[model samples]
Target: MAETKGLGYELIWKFDMPTTINHIMIMEDIQYGELIRKYKVEGKVNGEWRILTEGESVEHKRIQKFDKVEVRGIR
Candidate 1:
């Protein structure tokens, strides 16, 4: 688990090669208003970055699934 105390922080993951991604899960500590309330998930596809999912006022545990997409990185 990772945590940031301020706003505008980002977490990213990079893969060695293109891979299919079908699901994403985010876990957060229960910190009320201090928790992550909004976030966006993006993936690199065909040399371009695209948004796969986005949320506002999110909860402690969030999960998202979509049609498998080829990607080399996510943030």
Candidate 2:
């Protein structure tokens, strides 16, 4: 993945069926110092993409929580 100037790198995950998601956790290898400084989580709902969680200036571990939502795709 190539990192952009401001956008950074983007990764996506898709599922065949809608899955219930309540929490999301990201663990980065600390050996490389800080890998991700900012991140966002979005989900596809009712044919539209929505932001579920986002943050700025993260370090080794990041955990986000929200109301349980059923999603088929996430980025």
Regions more than 4 Å wrong, model 2: 1-8
Q: Report the lDDT tens digits of candidate 1 across residue range 1-75.
A: 132233357876777889898989988777644478788989989988999998875577778988899998888
RMSD of each: 4.2, 5.2
Q: What stretches of model 1 exceed 4 Å from their correct place?
A: 1-8, 31-34
TM-score of each: 0.79, 0.82
lDDT of 2 by residue, 1-75 (tens): 122133338767777778889988887888968878778889888778999999975677778899999988788
